[model samples]
Target: MSSEATIRRGVRNSRYAAIPNHVFEDSRLSMEARWLLSYLLSKPDNWTVVIGDIIKKGNCGRDKARGMIAELVKFGYAEREQQRADGKFGSSVLVIFDEPRDSHAAEIVGETSGVAFLPQTDLPATVSPSPVPPSPVKSAHSNNLDSANTDCQKEREGARAGSEESDTSVVEDRKRIERDFKAWYRTWPTSLNDSEQAARDAWAALTPEERAACIERTPTFISAVKAIKGKFTFSSVYLKGKAWEKLDDPKSEVALPTVHNPFSRAWMAGMLAILLRPPLTANMPAPTKFQLGQIAQGGDEADAVRIDRLQKYGWPRVNTMHQRAFDRQGVTVPPPLVAISEGFEQVHRDADLAKRWKRAFERRGWPWLPNTGHEWFFFPAGEPDEALAKFSEATARERGDDDAA
Candidate 1:
């Protein structure tokens, strides 16, 4: 029979539902299957075509086109009508089943005969008997099929087991390396800070693998240590070099200059205190005569002197003079510096009388006569009382304001 005739006969006897919407929802379907379905549905009969034509028109590989055809059949959307050519040279034709077979057959028959065949609603739901129990020989064949399925399952399980074991080993190795590296980094700094002999003692304790891992994971170790300590202050050249190397970008060609034996903030503070002397007797020695003159000026020049001293001594005081000068010409010092100086002046003023009294007593003899009853009061008696009272009043006011806030 012709491909179309065979399809029509099959449709007449076939009892199957229309293709479900969920089947085509899969994203894996190739572009060919989508086009093929739409093209076949447009025609009334299942058209036969060479598989090669499908591949060419679909713009896909032959294997891909074949896979798409197989998918459509598996999903109940299409069927293949295969034919064996009898000593013919021509390619075998493929008939695609487009619409639900029963529906198409009913429509075709109704159109040809001019009679509509209404589906029977009152017909009993018939359930066909399960296929006859397998014969003894067929039963043996079924057992062989089961054994084959079991073997295939076992092979798949073994492959999965091998993969899982490798993955577990990798995970354990990673965890162990991480633990060892953390412990090593914590102890590594001690060795770097120690004497040559002490460092050798510590280095000898570490394993070769641990040393390699430490080098590899230095950046991570530095970051973790910084987080735990809140800040990292390198005190020596060796520590600085190690830190820089750990944080350095490997892709860059230029090498950074190394810093050695970093200066302390305390050292800077002492140097600054010496450079910017107040009008006090127990003052630190000035670094230069110009700095001394600047300190004597007691305004912007005084601040400049202080800042210069601080910076020279390695303290990082923010340079506000440039910004201040930009905003308002002739304004040499910033407002923050002015505020700080004002606070200092207030403190000095509060202690002025006590300071004067103490100095006076030290230089000159006691003011009270030796025979007078006041000689028993050895320390400065009434001089600091007013200043102390004012200080207490100011402190109370400040506390009250803070509490209100």
Candidate 2:
């Protein structure tokens, strides 16, 4: 027999996909990717592909399944768009295209003729408005003139009532907007309130509901700015950009301490706690003057803001510069300490150890610096060897430093 494999033909089943020859013949896609595309194409229009279903069918691990999906996406077979629900960020919606989308294609899934994979949600069903009924036909010569006069009078009265209500509503809305604007403007940092007129314009442009959202979300946004120690955007700029949409519900921010006065002892203490903290990345040397100058020259403001947030909020607030800093030092940076069920108990026990370590650390003329997460204690050099060794071993184990090693 020849080296080429013998071909066999089978009857085409209704379930089989009628895929184009190019899907398999294309050099850009791997055999696995081709199979995945074919499998997806075989599904009925608008059929959602669950990752779990794909994993089960493919007999592959989650990563391998996801990798195949990603490969399809990379080759323009699918697109994912982030979605928002009830004013908070939600899971993405995937849209699969028969052909690759162009750069100028609409981002909205509904706009294109593509199969959408939407997550099933337990939200209440939406009630659509009822359609208007057709106007009743007029009967001739049956007290028509009297009916016409009565209808005209009713119309005039309704018009007068509606006009008065509309005028009153407009006045009230304007007053509320002005009152709310003043208060919101005051909440903004004094240094960044330069564009009052622009802010007013932006505010006026929003619907009543949007205005309420901006007002409600501004406090959390302010706290985030304060936490990062970043420069504030102009009120107008912030309003226009609608940056508040990205924030979580203010209820989740209860952990943040309320600052009644910035100069108060408690406020100062918290700020000191933040400022005196150890650097986010170990072995990241400080930038030299020349390097600093270069950093300042291009995109410094944005970079500084990003780095500050990362330092304040831990590594979940990612920063490439910090990653590179750790990489250069040959260090595997650990994720921020997020206390789980048993870890919470460990954190409480470590509290006493932390206090003892702090006392010893201070006696050695070293500053007591907490990590960003405030989950671990500081380790200053030149303390008693026994205390040092005990604290080192305990902290190393707690921080997963030993495991990493």
Candidate 3:
């Protein structure tokens, strides 16, 4: 029987996927991976699945689904590209079956006619300036207001201090809109090319009214994608397609996944780097990654600064390396830096362990003290379990002697 015929027997509806058979047979591919591939394969060509769609449909968390898809791509079983989505760049994820059986070819679907999608162009060289508002005449009456009403009068000052505040508001509003758009943009299932700069330019082109509308419907887009149901409107797609017009439609709310934060994400990466295993030394508790952000925090920096602010409130600041060193109760090894310190390559020598390891080295016909430039054994910066073992054996013998006495 053909692959399509067998798949149809298992699935009642055409919408439901029929996974490929070889995927299960390949012992290296995990079941989760197989399912993800099947899901992508079942879709029409150029069909995009956002991160939220994977989370919802795959019954997994946002990060897990993202990581799984990344592994799928990394393992060379999938290909992802950014192509035109209604004239703006959008992700196209496809299953890669290098040796796909002839029967499996019919399962995949889509029209490859390039006529509908045009390559996304950068921002136009010039933007038409917003219509200048007619100057408002400040009434002499505002000048007569008492101290209590002074703020009101100052706010109404035409084309002076008040105008400055209005301009500030416009700039700040654009910033807020861009920040929100980035939050949604980064959650895409695949990465983009020149995403940050491109997003900024597209965002600037949006009218104030359209920007507001897009912000309003962002939550709806988020919720719909998480349901694995509607088409996702990414920031680039929104800019090109004028998707803000669709915000008027009612949408059902689905509980949102933990939103992505570039800063907290860095922190979580540092946190997940906490490895405890044989290759690790007590001195080297897994290194954490926390690069200090820019000093001036504004615009897109809002989310990172907010997270750092919260982190400061919860966890007291300290010299992390020093704290780790003190906790380990072990001396530091010469860190391999590019400066003069890089020459400090003398390995740590635990005196007691070294004495015990010396005998073992000799017993094993390994060099303990050799000629100059020979591979003389020093305490390993990595796992030194053998040293510990010999020390334990010596102590055991001493205890035995005491018991006989």
Candidate 4:
């Protein structure tokens, strides 16, 4: 398992040591802070300890140890002491865990007993090559005086450090709030459409200050309202105005001017025209002027592919070829001819050709014939000769020619 995962698992399994009174002054103990407290209380005071030494002993990264120590100090679980430059014993505040049997608890007991019993592991070795006489016993009062001085100095240093950190955190919080404000401002929209009620509802949930910032940064809400109204007009009307009416509120509605403006009308109409244009499908190719002319002249047998290609390549002359053929053959071309001609027109505008073909089919005694929009033009059910004769006369009239009797 990864080292982080191992540490997390260890933390979960271990019981939390009771928080010290000093630590409770600051609210909340993070997991790392609690871990540091436990690790500190588990050991005797002496081990030549430092932040780096703790990292190596704990099997944690140096940066992680540093962060943990900072958090411990922030929550008052640990305190730092200042060492004197002379290498003599410096001021140090012993961190007292709330546990009854804590290392610091032993130290407190020792102070009252008038005998400081240093942990065996922390004591320096007494070394001598030859027998040496023992020194006279020092006064217990003097020892207590030294320890108290060191503890007081450590407490003062810790308090000063805590104050500095608190100031820095306050600044960081203010900056974070400012960043959130800017982000909210940039995303707020001035207008909403009929289908955007959910989005508006979400926006309304923001605080008044946030909403004001959004309105200031976005375009005027009136303009947005007008644009939405214009774009949704057809769809709203199709539903008998129910869609637009749903957005109205008797209490909160914003009043708009009633004056008609030509510029606004023109702009709205232009937008509508663009919106209503047929979308080009993946399979459809753009038509050329030549292809359009071929569709106009060729009765039915026109080559739609050839006309499509000629139009795509911007060659209008190719359409004149089909028109010339139509002129020479006259209007009464066979059904095969009419089919091809209709197909050419269908490539550019299927809806227009479908309507024309449906009308022609109905004019004949083929009202029951099924039509597939614009895919094919149906021939009436009858003898081939009779159908052909009727088609020829119709074609001649359609082409403004008199060849068909």
Candidate 5:
């Protein structure tokens, strides 16, 4: 047989109420009655006990509250005396004691004690009450009780202050968690739809260190999922499983698939033309013709570098560039560049590429080589009609296509 042991602790300078152990030890009293008795005893001697107060404190219905009080009264832990005012019967006032009183002794003591009872004027007409007057004399024991009550009050005040601080900390931490969750969610390739709330809750449950790990490892996970052609799971399930924890660091992952760019110079120029559209570029300073060419060339080179990195080191390598862009300039990787690096199939459907390029050039006020019949274009709002003549002839001579030109 297993033996059980009991342990007891005594309070030192800490705030606490003193109660007779017999109250708890008594088998005759109900647990509710014992608790109610302890609560009453913890109050100051002159404190009034009301049924409403008891109901609120115990979170119980009126019937249960009254029943507990009746139990205490039956056990001789409390007494009630009906009042008389102007020859009319009034509501009874109650007195609770830390120890039970004998019925015969209670009667004699009530007659001689002259205990004061406060009236409840604001209460229902059933109990018109008034305040109790303070006693003119204080004994040494009364002074000691006052000191203990003072300590209890101080302890309560300190506890309340600490609780407020703790609540503030919790609020601040939740705000930070929500902000980080939004950042992480933005990087997810697919929509979560209905699972968003559950995902947020799961993310909130993670420790700060775990959250950081999850955020840092997400790109690698995305790469793996894409590599295997696996379907993405709900964000809630991902977070709950701590899926990022199982993946190796992005730097060590290998066998990345090669990504290829499919945009020709003409197609790229058209895309760049859309990027530099008036409505979008209105906030940007107008670039010179030379500067526009440089911008297009530079943009193309950057896209090529990103594609190369994606093929060599996978998504994490390219995602690091996105992170750096945001961290350094508070911006995201440009959409066109992202589209080009993720898939070449999108660029393969190029049958309408030249038509779209023509439309873009027309909208942006650029014109094609006049004699060459709109084969090549010049940029930056307005250019001479023969702007590409010299370059086209030089290209024709190089290809031995002078007669074709």
Candidate 6:
């Protein structure tokens, strides 16, 4: 058994900010991006946090923070705008989660922030904070002291520092809200996908928990709807109704799986059912162009191996077939056994039927490719006939091994 390990950490006031669990659980973000997101959420309202401050406080280099910020903005988790150093109207504001529509500034006064940020492991506590508000009662008491001017001077200096910290916090917060807005804009699924403005309003109306829940369930809901519709797009669900709100409890559980039956396919007489692709009824197109990516493991090297397998085994068998008879007449009918196998497959979707037919055909040294969606042409194989015969023998032996077990 491993020993329990204790870790030491530094205390910071930013820990006061609450971070929701959903942000961390999001599969769309990287660890660094998520941590930066939490840090921005921890700042006081209306503060401007500069990149330099993030670099310094985040304990990360300039390039890393920049890249993380770029990634966040790209995915709609953060936003940024240029600001002029000369005091102007363009100064950034960390306007909580959403842009206020009807709520007056006076109304929101003293209201706690809807978003709270707490630091994660490998992240620094980010709440440098706004300058502390002056205590009116203390100022009144200090007025009686003879050294009031000195006290006032010290307070002024402290306020300036606080103002700077507050500005940094605000800047970071604005970036965070911008990300939230962008994320909503890009990801909100609807039935009739119009009215960006209405979407924004609906998004703002949702509580943080509701928004998080919607994001979590978006994929599952989209998939379930698509399986039922036969032709579903994000727009199919998104372009018509406010399906996002209904995502809190998904009604259907069905999901269309990968539309292929690659296993239980075999060779018969010298014929093999090398490909057993199923029809795609979902919004995605039937595969028009065949590539290794279609049947690949999706890594660069693995894809290369799949391509090699195709080139080595697949293309050669296709190339050497005798097409002379079909070219001369346009129809070279399969021998009697091949015709019967083709007829049987026309009405059945059974894998066992395909495999048994394939094995029986292979025993006679012919492999069978089905005619579910493509034209089947007959041709003579010189060398592959023997190759396919051996292939069938190996398959038969393997099946025997299974049966014996």
- Where does the lowest 10-residue lDDT sum fall in candidate 2? 1-10
> Least lDDT summed over 10 consecutive residues: which range in candidate 1?
135-144
Query: What is candidate 6's lDDT per residue for 74-155, written digit by digit as tens?
Result: 5555444323345542332222231112244313421333332323456655654345321112111112111211222222
Q: Compared to the true structure, candidate 5 yields what TM-score?
A: 0.25
lDDT of 1 by residue, 263-355 (tens): 111111121122222222233345588778878888978866664454433212212222222333122221112222222221122256535
Question: What does candidate 4's lDDT look like per residue over 32-142, in tens digits?
Answer: 656666666543332123343345446687678768766655544454543333665433323323222346644544554442343435443343222321111112111
Identify the runs in model 3 with alpha carbons over 4 angstroms from their true place.
Answer: 1-18, 82-405
Q: In model 6, which runs have C-alpha deviations exceeding 4 angstroms? A: 1-16, 82-405
The C-alpha TM-scores of every prediction are 0.19, 0.26, 0.21, 0.19, 0.25, 0.21
Off by over 4 Å in 1: 1-31, 44-46, 84-93, 99-405
* Residue 30 lDDT, candidate 1, scale 0-100: 54
By lDDT, is 4 or 6 better? Answer: 6
lDDT (Cα, 0-100) at 249 in candidate 5 = 26
Candidate number achieving the greatest TM-score relative to the actual structure? 2
Instruction: Provide the lDDT at 344 for model 4.
Output: 24
Q: What is candidate 1's CA lDDT for residue 1?
A: 24
Q: Compute the lDDT of residue 377 as modeled in candidate 4.
A: 29
**lDDT, candidates in the order shown:** 0.35, 0.45, 0.38, 0.34, 0.46, 0.38
- What would you estimate as the lDDT of candidate 3? 0.38
* Candidate 4 local Cα displacement, residue 381, angstroms: 40
TM-score, prediction 3 = 0.21
RMSD of each: 26.1, 25.2, 28.5, 25.5, 24.5, 24.1
* lDDT, ranked from best to worst: 5, 2, 6, 3, 1, 4
